[model samples]
Target: MPEFPHDDTTTNPFAAEPQDRLDANPRRAIVTGADSGIGRATAVALAAAGVDVALTWHSDETGAQETADEVRTHGARAVVARLDVTDIPACGDVVDGLIDELGGLDVFVNNAGAGLQTPFLDVALDEWNRVLDTDLTGPFVCLQRAARAMVAAGRGGRLIAVTSVHEHQPMVGASAYDAAKHGLGGLMKNLALELGHHGISAVSVAPGEIATPMTGQTDTDPRTEDRPGIPLGRPGDAREVAALIAFLASPEAAYISGASVVIDGGMLQMGPQAGAAVDTHDWRTL
Candidate 1:
């Protein structure tokens, strides 16, 4: 088994102590960016919990199909679609497409995002736009579509988003990412307030460093040795984050809304991790 950051037996302070809150096990959800990384894990976890999943992919149809197959192996129907979150206008159509295919949408997880790590000084306008459009506006588009569907169905629904630890804290060289996530956090909160009367809830799950392809960094990398800063003394696993999303999407988490659950192993609370030491003897100016 591949060891993950949070694979240890030690307890996590951020997660709900008793996961019994989600015992009802609601089925049927749409997970955006479900082709790989944390999104794929969430889709699989939901399937394991008996949730039929509509898994969306952007540039990887094959990857999306693979996730769908996994979902089916878990005994839950899996619907796959190629969805580009940045295509703002088509977002509504995507939701309707999922609902039409899956029969109905009870839970919506906005997990599609693009990470931009350009320095603030060198960050271009287009980069900022791209990050904001995907991380913030994209979710809003899905939220609007999902909210309408939930209201029409006359049943309360769950609207969840996967933000980043930067949603609340700041990180150097991540200006675009930080701003977008921060905006997304605020967006979810506002949606929660507006939709609460209609029995709909919106929330965000912010993850820290996870052993995902996006980071391009591994546990063994000496640069990651400062994991001690995180109370858990390591990064988190994709599955661990998925578990939380599954719980929130279920009927049991109905009372939780407008909340941003930080799953960074207490890293955010402890402040930024120390910058890795680097050797700089030979240098060239570009």
Candidate 2:
């Protein structure tokens, strides 16, 4: 593997000691779709790291406010906004409003997304367009706005997107989601290439089989017997994915850019053969 270059040149007059990096607080961050699941978890994680958060949710003001309260409880300032990623102009407005409300933005997390669970052959054109718009275009717009501000400020920044494992692998009954996530990863890579010279790093976090409401899985013991293909033999929690995002956004990961990190509990390592050869004895139980 070729090593990437690290830019360690910083001439901040008021910069804190290197060892006390974590003690330094970031002014603000924006996390979209933060009303539930991974988005909520990531918002809280950033707050715990002493970053004020501007969170957005659609059709769930109460949930969004609840997450904002959690951020406050973590000793970080919080602001909640209603946003629909499908509305392109609204994305820019939201970023502007959040920056105005929070003073400035140092990090932006594009976690808003939608999925359609239908066979590819049965999907409609509108369904495809809707997913692509929300998953890919929304992030692109938000990223553009955030990058402009970060570059203008010349303060360096972090841009991250919560994609899905489908970014790299395809799934049946999830054509739109797969295509959108793939596009998202590509978008991040392109942005990373362009933004690197400006001291802004772009990254994508792809998660797999996370235990969230979207999976329709109850809050029960994660299954292992039926999930032998995964090397870890279980599903991942939203917080586990959040932890990775937090790291990606941290100063420690400054040298990492244009990278799509997959957190799948080793599921991606298991090809279809592992699940296909399940014992007949297990089939009887199902």
Candidate 3:
């Protein structure tokens, strides 16, 4: 075998000194779409971990207040704000404002997202724009602002996006949703690479069939529902996903960057098996 040349001058970009990892204990965090579901759960979970939380809601101020109340029950300070991710650059200002209110930032979770069930041929320009802006472009702006705050604070940080299993696999009528998630996944990966030198880590949490308002299953107990296709035989609860997100924001997960952690109860593994088992053409429609 021929000898492989190594560039000795290039050091490990991910290496950081103990002093550079100041935010290892993550004092503060911001969670978007926190009025309900995964966002609310994440807020509460982070609070339980002793991290103060700033939560954002779009149209449900009441629900946001409820989340804040729960966070406060954990003895953690909670701030509430409105965040419409589809609003583009204006949405970024909301993130900055939240950071200012929280005093600083250590963990930023881009959990606000929208989904569409329209087929590819029926997806209109307006709908496409809305989904794309909400899921991808808006997250870009918000994450950028959060990253800047982290860099300015000179503390290590965590940037996490709540993607979907569709980030890796496609569904019947989720053309726009899938595309946006794919883009967001790629964006997190790139952020991980670029921010590593700053002692910041970026990751994506890709969930499967979760029992949340977005799934038309509000106030549901996922354990009671049956999902034969999934190895776990049930839909996931928002709290379960929240636990994972909270762990990722902790110092223990410092090395887990640029990864799409799937908490789907093994739903993606059944793809080929499900495809072969289906004896009808029903899979082609929503």
By TM-score, the best candidate is 3
- Give the per-residue lDDT digits (tens) of candidate 1, residues 128-237: 89888888887788878988887787566788999999998887678888998999999999998888766678899999988776776533332354676678788788
Q: Per-residue lDDT for 1-286 in model 2, tens only?
A: 9986543447554333443332233568999999988889999999999999999998889889988999999999999998888898787888888888988788999999999888888899999999998999877888888888887876778899999989998877888999999999999999888887667789999998888767876354455335666788888888898899888888788778999999998878776665567666553321
TM-score of each: 0.83, 0.86, 0.94
Which pairs, if any, clash in model 2? none
- Return the lDDT, model 3, position 43: 99
Ten residues in sequence with the least summed lDDT for candidate 2: 15-24
Evaluate candidate 3 by giving its C-alpha RMSD to the native, one decimal. Answer: 3.4
Show model 3 residue runs off by greater than 4 Å: 1-14, 20-23
Give me candidate 2's TM-score against the actual structure: 0.86
The better candidate by TM-score, 1 or 2, is 2
lDDT of model number 1: 0.81
Superposing all C-alpha atoms, what RMSD in Å does each candidate have to the true structure?
Answer: 10.0, 5.2, 3.4
lDDT of 2 at 233: 80
